[model samples]
Target: MHLAFVAFLVAGISDAVDGFLAKRFGWQTELGAYLDPIADKALLVSIYVALGYYEYLPAWLVIAVVTRDILIVGAIMLSGMINRPVQMHPLPVSKVNTAGQIILAALVLFDQSFGLNLVKLTTITVWVVGLLTVTSACAYLLTWFRHMSAYEADVHSSLKQQKDGSQIKPRHFGQNPRA
Candidate 1:
């Protein structure tokens, strides 16, 4: 447990340092933008699952966290399949939720490692994490639905225009229409 706590601490610190360096040095890349969130999600999900499996955290909380992540990823993939790829961005609520999750996990690990009784704190954290998780999921879903709806509307409008013979035709460069 002590080793695990230390490892988690190191991971968190490293993530912070990586972000700082990226921003401070203007070294950000498109791939880094994608990988950073994926790495954070992977770490959080893995820790939550392990804690839940060992009965350290409530099963419901673990399920909620995992399910939200799965839904978001699934939605992104679905959007791509439908020719509307959603760009990944951390919504404000999602950032809060992630912070709460990280804190809760670290608190649990710290309490376990040091054999400290932090049940009250842990209980409060559990509720915060749960609430934030649900709120974030709803926000993301709502945004995705709106984006898809708008895309569909645009497609419908274009089709209608084409059917009415009012759509603009593309002209080739250096070609004379009189020819």
Candidate 2:
């Protein structure tokens, strides 16, 4: 457990370091974009599973966390496979959700290490994490739905324009075609 806590701390620190380097040095790459999230998710999921197995956390919460990540990864894969890759920006609620999960995990590990008996804090954190997880999932789903709807509308509009012999084309500003 202690080793796990240490590893978690190291992972958190490394994430900050990598992010700083990416922004400061303009070292962002296509691979980093995908790898960073995958690494984070892998670490988080592993920690959650370990914690649950040891009875530090609830199994249902563990399932929820793992399920959410699976759903997200699955959606991203499906989108890419269909050649309609969606740009995923972390929503504010999702950021809060990540923070809540990190805090909860840290607190649980700390309590276990020192026998702090922080039941009240643990209870509050668990609820926050659970609620945020569900909300973040909903937010992502809603965004995906809206994006698909807009894309469909655009396709329909273009098809209609084509069939009506009114194909829209870009024109330069202050330029008239008949001039």
Best by lDDT, which number? 1
Q: Highest TM-score among the candidates is held by which one?
A: 1
lDDT of 1 by residue, 130-175 (tens): 9999999998887777767665665677787677655333221112
- How does residue 111 of candidate 1 score in lDDT? 100
- What overall lDDT goes with each candidate model? 0.86, 0.78
User: Candidate 1 versus the native: TM-score?
Assistant: 0.87
TM-score, prediction 2: 0.85
List ranges where model 2 is wrong by over 4 Å. 161-179
Error of 2 at 31 (Å): 1.0
Pairs in clash, predicted candidate 1: none
Q: What's the lDDT of the predicted structure labeled candidate 1?
A: 0.86
On residues 132-161, what C-alpha lDDT tens digit does candidate 2 reach at each position?
999988877666666555555655778866
**How far off is residue 107 in model 1, in Å?**
0.4
